[model samples]
Target chain A: MNIDAFAFDFQELNKEIKSSGQEELNIDNCMGQRYIGCGLSRGSLRIRGVPGNALGAYLNGADITVHGNAQDSVGDTMNEGKISIHGSCGDTPGYAMRGGKIFIRGNAGYRAGIHMKSYRDKCPVMVIGGSAGSFLGEYQAGGRIIVLGLGSDQPCPVGYFCGTGMHGGKIFLRCGQLPASLPDQVNAKLADDVDLQEIEEDIRQFCAEFDLDRETILDHPFHVLTPNTKNPYRQLYVHC
Target chain B: MQIDYFYPEYEVVRNKEKCTRCGLCVSQCSNHVHSYSEEHRRMITDDAKCVNCHRCVCVCPVGALKITGSNHQFKHNANWSRRTIMEIYSQAETGGVLLSSMGNPKDMPVYWDKILINASQVTNPSIDPLREPMETKVFLGSKPASIERDENGRIRNNLPPHIALDVPILFSAMSYGSISLNAHASLVHAAVDLGTCYNSGEGGLHDDFYRYSANTIIQVASGRFGVHKEYLEAGAAIEIKMGQGAKPGIGGHLPGNKIVGEISKTRMIPEGSDAISPAPHHDIYSIEDLRQLVYSLKEATGYKKPIIVKVAAVHNIASIASGIARSGADIIALDGFRGGTGAAPTRIRDNVGIPIELALASVDERLRQEGIRGNVSLIAGGSIRNSADVVKALALGADAVYIATGALVALGCHLCRGCHSGTCNWGIATQDPALVSRLDPEEGRRRLVNLVSAWTHEIKEMMGGMGINSIEALTGNRLMLRGVGLNAKELEVLGIMHAGE
Candidate 1:
């Protein structure tokens, strides 16, 4: 449906869009109204202004694009969908997501992708163009998290203890140097051709959306982090 | 030679005449006070073994057992008395951690006891419970915002989903793992019979008890264990357990050892792995976040179920209740400090949170002031002891009362405060196969039903005496209650008047 700039409750507008028999929905003056295109299975939501927290929470199979920065907890606990943010997003961009793709063009706040999990044939992916905050992917159970440091001078775009309590999943960082004080549970190493192959599709999709060269992004040294299986910590207490 | 130390309170006495050769108590005692001698003709009783629960005394079939208070000389001073000495000794033994159960066992004034119930005297006539139709039935759910009518002026879907209780009492959340399967079955069956609801605690619903969904309030805590499509659909309502009163600000930990076969399966955790429910739902950072979860569950359940947010009665409970009322929750369950637990850090259980009476009154008053009392129904629980406490809770503005410890007491809980050990002699709190088998569901359920029915009769009697015929009339009727020894702050928080003038 073709629409013009109007101050509408994003929730109501999104509801209208889902119920309407239209392929494209253009929401204008959408100032901080939440759950836009949330749980929508088949549709395209195009927004002009800033969206609120949980922009596409539990999104099943729709596609959402935000013209401006999105709030915290974007695509939170979602099962499937694709969210492309033209501007930077806030913290916990893909929290507890089981399946989906979240592509952000700017920096993410603390603990992004925290508790993100995955299952067989459904590994969620998150790509950030700028730096991420401390404790990134804290307690991440599963899923792939990639941070591409494009125009930043920081040695590492991610912060200290990047993958604390990370039991499963892989984290790819497009930086030469790894953080010094990584947790003992996680093993960090230079990404080889095999590591690059896993996140190749996600990087290509991110490059295609934001007009970045995938080969140049892959040329930089990458660090892949996975949980160390040998040094497993167990039995922290006595029963009696 | 080392002398085995007893509590200095109990004296173990045995009858020499009816002494049996069987030394079952000797092997049963965990204190190691009993020993068998091949040469001895009869079993010997050592005085240093008992914690005064009288388990051995009650077990002996031939009536050969007796226990009494030892005549250990403490200078007769009321201030420095036996209880004081015991407290000190307990602290010394457990290194200053005082663990207790079944409400505050200390000398602190019990407000429920001090508060007196008023009845109609000469001016207003009293109705006898036997003759009059005194309404003890309570329905817990969201009442309609306003009645709606059809074209013919007939009622059209005016009623909200509610649990109709024969009395304003319910079995509170004591999980299957914390107690036993038989105990859970007993509670479920009793709740069905008694026309009340039984909470499924944080433990997931047992497969066998799926038929009792109408009487079950399934819980979802931080762990979200066994919480899926079926678990949500298999309940009358969903309770989001935010904080437990017994151990406020602390999460639940069903130790790996207790997680056996079915318990492990229901909790959806590996056997021998501690089911650690973190103190908070990581996603629930604010009231708005709580609303998301509440609505999500409602959506998942097709909005057929009312959502209950159970929170611990902390110091600032009134303010918190205000926020919860606006969080789209249909019911607010307030658990006080005196509530029971399978296991909690001793410090948190006894030393934290406020009394339920004050919390209930404050929350009701706060919601009323905010003009949102109609938004949510309040169910108060912590240590609702008897019919008197139930009536008092209603008068204090609770729509209903949740009873866990009281129900367990009916089903053979001794309140030994040793639930952490999981060797519950009464078979009410243990997960051991043998101990759990001891409690037959048939008999246990009957006991619970009897307890609730008896309490219902007492509640009706109390209501009839006050000339209040209905539970709805009794709710927030503070005039029916008067404080005897409560201070100004207590009386203010309780929203009741002092005894005289």
Candidate 2:
């Protein structure tokens, strides 16, 4: 079923999509409609044009592909599913998301993948083709975030304050050098064969989705960032 | 070393004549305060190790054990008191922020005690609750202005969702990581039995408690821990936790040690990883951002559940609440500075935020002045001590009240203020398996039910005395309340008249 989404607001468009009784939907002319495919399961959506903030919030088990640029919080707290953005997206692309995969072909704004987590057999993954903004993976508890830095000229693909307050999970950046402003609580090292091998499939998947060569994306020296497990804030409080 | 060493605050006084030396206190105290010496043939008590939780006192078979405040005093000075000096010494020694549990134990005024309720005289007849129908039930949600009608002259049902409560009390948010799972079980069971609701704090709901979804209010905080699509759909309502009362501006940090076992699974984070809730939701910078979250939740839940926005009672709370009331929220839950927490910084808990009484009064007045009071229901919390406090809150404009410290008291908490230590003598706070096993969920549930039931009876009695048959009638009825010792400015802020006026 194809939805014009031209005459309807977010509420009406969502209502029509929910009651459309179709397994697959193609939303066209979607200009800044927020919360598209929110909390939806058991359906596939293809959206054209720009969607507003919280594009696929709390989305459970639905496949959403945005043909154009998306706004902030693209997959806020989404549980299970896959979201693919063909163009650049705004901040917090996968904020607090668990058990899903979000693929962005172009650059992402600040705080991308902040607080992304995972559970047993439900690891969340985000693959950004281009560079990412500052505070990437801030306070991330679980999951994997990969920044390919496909066309960036900077030595590092991520901005300042990368992995600030990160307690769990790993971030793979295809870069020559690590960010200088990395916090002491975070440990960054050059990725070895084992580390590169683990996320190779994810990089390949991102390359395949964006019609790029996997070998070219993996040619650069990669760096992995993980939180120091010594419990950074342990001695910060005393009983009163 | 002598300058740094301080005397214990409490001393255990054991009666030598009545003591049977059963060693019950030695086995009962989790803080290792009591130890029996084989050579001495008696139990030795360590006052410094004691938190004064009353566990040893209650468990002793003989009526021989009692704890008393030690007379060890510094040169009494108005400016530098013993507690004040001790806190300074503690911080100087450890160079760490002082952390405290439960509510503020400060010397601030509690306005609930100053406000008095009115009774009926010969002009108005007091209805007996037993003989007459006195309704304590309340429905919390946005109230529609007028009924819609169809073209055929029939009433159209366009009312929004509401949470029906048998009483005007709810079990406030206490996350699984903060409290034991059994504590959550007890609160949820009591809520189900009482026909009310329990809030699942920032920590996600456990899988076992999904059966109680009919009485659950799942919360979404800055961290979004354990929040998923199923969790949202499982709740009777959803609450967006903007801020907590104890530490108004600061965020919550459940130490890495407490994030173990079910907490790790429920929160969906790795074991031994810190569960940090940032102070602000990154996506929400303004009321428009709040509206986005509120609608996102509504869109996720299909607009079937009422969305509650819980905020701390801080300065500029009236305007903040006005903004929230217009942010498409169905309920506004205001938690005052005196509200309890599993753990919070001592300075932040004691000094931050304002009293719920004044905040509620001003927010209620502001909303009513703007003619948007019906847009959202108000639930006030922070130290609702007794039934009188509940009645006073309603008269001050709260649709209902939330009880956490009072509820934990019913669950056998002795207010030791040691929750941050993760060794609660009672099973209410700690996650230790042995300590957690001490509290039986059934027993806790019964005590909570008894507390709410007793409060409900007293509320009916108070409502009957006021000649108000329902809680709705008493809500915002400030004429029924009079200030006693409050000054003119305090009385004006409370929107109540002085006594005899």
Best by DockQ: 2
lDDT of 1 by residue, B1-501 (tens): 323243446677778788674676674554544556678765655665455655566677777777788988578997897666666655655454444434545444557897888899887778898887888787777777788999999989966567677778888888878899999989999999987899998878999988889899999887565565577779988999999888889777676578789987786544654555657766688999888777666555656788999999999999999999999899999999888887765567767898888889999999999988988889999989999999999999999999998888888776766666676766777787767787899999999999988888888888888998999999999999999888898898888899885
Report how far off residue B396 is in candidate 1 (Å). 0.7
- Interface DockQ per candidate: 0.13, 0.73
Ten-residue region with minimum lDDT total, candidate 1 chain A = A231-240
- Segments in model 1 whose C-alpha atoms lie over 4 Å from true places: A1-108, A112-132, A135-153, A157-240, B1-17, B23-57, B65-105, B144-161
Q: Candidate 2's residue-wise lDDT over B203-322, tens digit each?
A: 999999988988999999999998888899989999999998998988889988898999999998878888888888988989999999999999998999999999999999999999
Q: C-alpha displacement of A185 in model 2, angstroms? A: 1.5
Alpha carbon lDDT of residue B442, candidate 1?
94
Candidate 1, residue B314: how far the Cα is off, in Å: 2.1
lDDT of 2 at B394: 98
Local accuracy of candidate 2 as per-residue lDDT tens digits, A1-240: 999989999999999989998989999999899999999887899999999999999989999999999999999998999999999999999999987899999999999999888777888999998899999999888899999888889888899999888888899999989987999779999999999998988887787777889887787799999988636678889887
- Local accuracy by lDDT, each model: 0.79, 0.92
Report per-candidate TM-score of chain A alone. Answer: 0.94, 0.98
Listed per model in order, the count of residue pairs whose N, CA or C atoms clash below 3 Å is 0, 0
